[model samples]
Target: MSNEKRPYKGGHGKPGHAGKPGNGKFSQGNSNQGSGQGEGGAKRKRRRRSGSGAGVNEQNRQQSQNSQRTQNQRSQGRPQKWDDNSRGDKKRFENRGENRNDSRAESRTGRRFDGLTSVERAARRAKTEHDDTKRGGGGTSQRNKSGHERNRRSMSAREFSAAAPSARSRTADTARATVFEVLRSVAESDAYANLVLPKAIRSHRLDHRDAGFATELTYGTLRHQGTYDAILRHCVDRPLEKVGTTTLIVLRMGVHQLLNMRVPAHAALNQSVSLAREKIGAGPASFINAVLRRVSERTPDEWYELIIEDAKDDTERMALLASHPAWIVRSMRQALVAHGRPATEIEQLLEADNLAPVVNLVALPGLGSLDEAREQGAVDGELVEGSALYASGDLARLESVREGTVRAQDAGSQLVARALAAAPLDGTDTAWLDLCAGPGGKAALLGAIGVQRGASLVANEAAPHRAQLVESSMRPLPEDSYTVLTGDGRQIRETLRKNASALPGSIEPGQLFDRVMVDVPCSGLGALRRRPEARWRKSPRDIAELLPLQRQLLDAAIEATRPGGVIAYVTCSPHAAETQNIVAEVLESGAVSLLDSAAALREVALHTEGANGESVSVLAGEKDPGHTPEIKVKKGAPAVKAAENPTTAQLWPHVHGTDAMFLALLRKN
Candidate 1:
């Protein structure tokens, strides 16, 4: 198969010019090895270059040293992209997360999403609405030697001219010489992964393979940061806290390559160390090398065993291996366990997150049927039964995607929409509303499906600019099938239902959608991999801050649907407060009725009796009919399955091989 046979996708050990390793000033055998400072003739050259007389030229030498250090501030990488020198060394490592002013024992908060194995993760979450501090990197030099060293250090103008910048510096490991830097910047500054990675890769001019490598490296380093830091601490001599930010990140990049990456240990070490010596200065290189070598001495198993030995329980073990913080693992484990998953599944869930996600695309329903799109060159069809094609390449690169005939939607989102519109259709246009449709991935798919099945869709969005996205989402469909409106959907619904209100509604009676999709905006915790920087950017507190907004959005969605209309409450989060609690509150309010998804998906899969042996999230029968997603369940399943529901809450890249999405289908009584 081209996927496996593709030359570029080869793993480590496949033939390539993997570079040489360990490039320090002094080492064995190589011609240039052991040829620099501290070697036999070095003191004589220093004295000779020191020059017999010291005066104006001596003062000139001091200024020169300061100038060279300052010039590096504007190197080609992200922390500072363009170079305009004659400043202090403080400008170079600004994004390194190692600010001298910041507290060394700063509060550890951004780690709550690590997917731990207990409910403690939830109750432990505190609000992160505190003083936000930007990273002040590169204010000091790595070679300052002493922590008490001055923030700005420069000698007089009489210093030496021969003291030039190191020769080992080059572009970078990515297609673009500066992609890694860009990645670090996004993580430190923007906290946007989807926005940055592609831009960096494209700018670097790397092919698909190299782009993949850069992408993996960026995310992997972020994901396993805790473990990497431990290994890095083992390798570097000085306290890592004292290390300059830029150099520390460089070491982190190197450590990732050494431990988890497939790149040969030598290539990883040499290139990284060389970059370090030049970027950071001399002393750190040998220190970096010593640390890396010691870390490399252990196999992955040995490392896992060692790290996990410290974990006293399943939560700790899963957190360590899966690269999640204990709190996150604990919270998710609770939500998942209620959905019938085991605690051990937490590790598997985390591992799955680190793997590259298969791209999924939805064939816009009315614009092009899945079958028609497959015929039009959508490859990898029929991989997952309901899914037509496994998205490859930049789906956005396809004119079809740009033209809005197909969209890059997670299958989980597809299923959520499907579950919302899943009921037996009575061959006439049923009004459907996709509330909050912006940059419209799901809205477009919903529009397409609604169009195909004799239904009309009203896409309501909060932002006018984003409302255009709703229009763009429906661009491929026929004009009469949908309309895009900008307004708070909840208010719009209330006005329509009000007895004495003069508020204009986007639609009149009979125009109300039979199904409403509230793909409510949440903390977006589910999309960590694609959004590498989000890991560093999010605090456990972001969740609580979003609760009110989530509640309002859910209320809006609930109000928009007509009686007997289905409403699909969806979020990328599997969080209980966001998922079940939201729905449970609605149930308590007695506004609408919960409908059985099994009945909605009766055309797809469900089983009441155990006709064969199979494991379902909730298999409540003696005869398990060995159900699959493809099997159409013909019996009853409730919208709310009490504590005994068979939903895995639709986890991603794990169960459906897509993003984690929660789905609850409710029908108005």
Candidate 2:
């Protein structure tokens, strides 16, 4: 048997390049690492060159520094203002729960949802009526008194009615109006629908049903915008750029409901027209009505087939029919080929992106109990230990989540963190590092695991505000077991190698950690289902730009790892350029050697059990047993090949029921 065998359908790795670690820079030798700016020097200089120079630039820079200072001061105990420069950064803040107001300190009331839609209001009314029906014994006066008490606890009905925009008078219009605002924000400011939708749901007090509707409308419209735009091109007399962004958003929402949602064509049309008339004037409303009427003339399947009929090639046809940009389809195809999987999986991958991902949560080991969560309606996640999949109920209502125990974490993320901690170590295995610990989901899990192992973890995030979030997440763990640092990860190896004061008690001065997790920043293409707006926001240039930083971060992680210890190079991306390419580049440089990451993950899965300690079996071959993706597996493929070691693993949404996470375990020589 040869070493050329693949481990699983989507896992592969190469032996790393043979070289001694110098300074953690990408350059081979005589390296002088740049200052502790988050990104590479070349990238920063490129950004500076794009800006105005000298006096104005210097003045603007000073203002930015001052603003950051004020933000840090305000976010001392809270999550900081979002990073305006990158959508990925904004998402990190949102994931860390830093974007919301201080939960333990601030009141949810008084934060009004000013643009309440009619549909949202109706849902609330129906819920209240149902409650009244359940309490049928109450007399009229008694019921009135009870209603007054409820109003005192929350916003009164009159106040809630007044809070909604006057134009949105219909009871069933709330979700549509909410979708419009979120879509408008995404169009104007590149805000993420996933992040914005939750806040809107909370502020508007949308019940579970209404929230689900808004989510479907928002994600569906954004995901299928390309196909809808193609349809609109044939219908509209003017270019989309000429149409107002608001009107276009409304039209897209109406089109989505008409084509994809269970909503009736007439209801979709009438509600959309009403929305346009209320928000933009009757003239645009008439245009919307005409366009939507034309859109509803055919079913979704018929429309998609017709739209792609004139396509010159299969790729273009798939791109249009699947509602993905052609460039994304191409990139995904290349990514699949590069990762050793059949390139034919791109269609299934793109289709998977359009589908909603299941909500995954992790019960922080020792601090939270998965059994408690399961009792509260969460089903045990089949893949990883201390993980559950729950869809309904407010997460904050759960005691473990509210009290800072279990957190909403993707199973892929939990797997990677656990793999890093559980990787075989020699001698002392008491110190660890999370190099890019933003919003600290992995760090929280690591911290919990560290407590069990009698180890300490140093969680480092470049952004000050994000570091604060890491601190908050790790707060439940023993204080002496972890330390949160606000510094650049690229500087970690040098900083710790020179002076141990940087990380304090987590690691002795000048001593490397036993395990390091380099969850490097990337284009985040793997999590498209969770972050629906991200697919449209990312570009090819993003992958190109991120490659250098990823390489440097991986090098830094290698430099920071003890010789016998291991480093987990993880990314929430399946893009070949950002995942395998980065790993291959580092391996070619000879700084470290690859471990059997697939076997390590298998070990993690095998050892990870339920609350009773019975071994939990995890299947990676297919996501849903009944609905396995139609893969074009070649003939003569082995069901389970042995004697070949694969050092990397790529988890996919369609295959593993997780984000397309890439993990590579490399041990420093």
Candidate 3:
């Protein structure tokens, strides 16, 4: 060899001779050793050799030989010295060939091998690996653990139900289920518990005892929801809003049973947790269990003290303690003072709102009798005539109730309707009107009384559905005794004026009613005891919104009455704006004058004694001799004597055990 290196010839070593396996360098060929060329000539010769078919065939042969050698070494259980490098080179050659085929296939089909795109392939591979890991086929211990966690997280509904509390744990009580369904309906669909509860009780076929239990549980839970939420906030780790609604309702029921009812702590906890697991999920059930455990650590009184400890004032403290909104507390206090009641009674009133009201029933005066109800252990009402207090069970069991001869009516409502019927009117008092009489509890009583007085009643409701209810309520009475009209109460005067001849009754054309009952729509703050959830639903804005309509309806009532006719303005609320203020504004028109409503209520209460001769005294202020004078003024010349208490009557839940119904009797002048 010359001092300068000769240009390389193409081959591993000499033509047709393989290089020594461990040399790590190719052998030089003798074909162009003497006729030497420069580097350029060597490059051109190498390119030509690489592009030739012989070179490709040689590469394939070398790869096959390497694979065969490796296989033979593995089969014979002998380690090959040069196995790593040879195997790697062979794999690279195979991969390159595969890449070319893959490129062509993808270009033609727009997909990779296995008929899947890249994204699809990735997803399929991941799923396959997950399945393998789940089956304990091939994965690390960490991956297997993660797979188990995922499986647990994605458990089916049936599996979760199976994992719930045992069936033998007294968790499937029908009464509790009924209560839960009612609460869920109220929370989810904004349905009234009074409307949904009875139907649910019927559908569940609950007995009298179970019905009573369900009633108490549902009302107690709703009444104390605010207080329970306060206590739950103390027990829970996060805000209550973050909790699921169904879970929160379950917790509320549980708390009510624990603190308010006679239920044992263990029973309450297990039943509530069971309900959660049954209705909600196992995870939420666990959360409820943990929280309820924390709640059971303290007594209800202790929780009350702790929760009210941070109150900024008496109103807020009472709001938390009595389970009422703070604004409602303040409004109640204002209402007490405005309605001639002492402001100190707000606490009693709020506590009363939490108490479940008794089902008050009224027998339609002449056409209905209380014999059926009395035979079934019903006691006479203490607030109004022809009314009874039913505490036994579902009122549906009473034949009179089913016959519409006796209907469920609040005592306050009975008092107002009776007062309106008893109100003195000049000339013939034979024609009456019950404006805004929907779902006709009052209308039924008034119509029955009217039939006895030889009077015809026209019950008007704004909604067609409610008008039907009014008609249904009066079905027990003679069909000719009352007529149900579906129309706006505000337009009653005009409608009558336009169609006076078409009116149903022994009335002359263009004749107005002798008595008109404007039991106007109101915020229903007065009936909170009967509708516990209403406390949370109402706001001051609701009263404000109803003001104009109330005034209009009252005005219409006055206009629709004869000059000497009596108009009874009634509301199931004691809010000043909805009651006294509305009466005052309508009175300012000088078309009507306020009468002694308190005296009328007292008269009605006196004539209507309970079966045991007990009666509720509805008189307040100086009108009531038992009233202790809270404010005393020295006999002086220039003192305004507490603006001589308005003659309007207001029934109180705490005082009379009736809804805080407001009544203002007016006479068209």
TM-score for each predicted model, relative to the true structure? 0.64, 0.69, 0.72
In terms of lDDT, the poorest run of 10 residues in model 3 is 625-634
lDDT of each: 0.57, 0.73, 0.78
What is candidate 3's lDDT per residue for 1-669, written digit by digit as tens?
222234434433225322323344444544344333557657755775676745865775686687677689889999765756586665665687788788988898886647577799888876676566445344223323335422223224332433323332435578888898899889878889999999999999998888889999999999999999999999976589867677788899999998999999999998887787667665567668889999999998899999998999998999999999999999889888887779998888898898888888888877778888788888887656677877777888877788898888888889889989887667989888999999999888888888887888888899998889888998898877777887899999666666565566676666788999999999999888878899888888888889999998988888889887899999998887787777766655566667777777887774434568875453533334121112332343233322234377888889888898888888777
Task: Write one digit per residue (lDDT tens) for candidate 2, span 501-567.
Answer: 6454646877888899999998898888888778778888888888889988888888888877789
Collision pairs in model 3:
13-27
Give the range of the ten consecutive residues with the poorest summed lDDT in model 2.
5-14
Residue-level error in angstroms, candidate 3, position 15: 51
Alpha-carbon RMSD to native, per candidate: 27.5, 39.4, 12.3
lDDT of 2 at 211: 85
Q: After superposition, how far is residue 71 of candidate 3 from its true place, in Å?
A: 42
Q: Count backbone clashes in candidate 1.
A: 45
Total clashing residue pairs per candidate?
Answer: 45, 13, 1
Q: Which residue ranges in model 2 land beyond 4 Å of their true spot?
A: 1-172, 494-506, 606-617, 620-644
Better of 1 and 2 by TM-score: 2
Better of 1 and 3 by lDDT: 3
Q: Give the Å error, residue 456, model 2.
A: 0.6
The Cα error of candidate 2 at residue 428, in Å, is 1.2
Give model 2's TM-score versus the native structure.
0.69
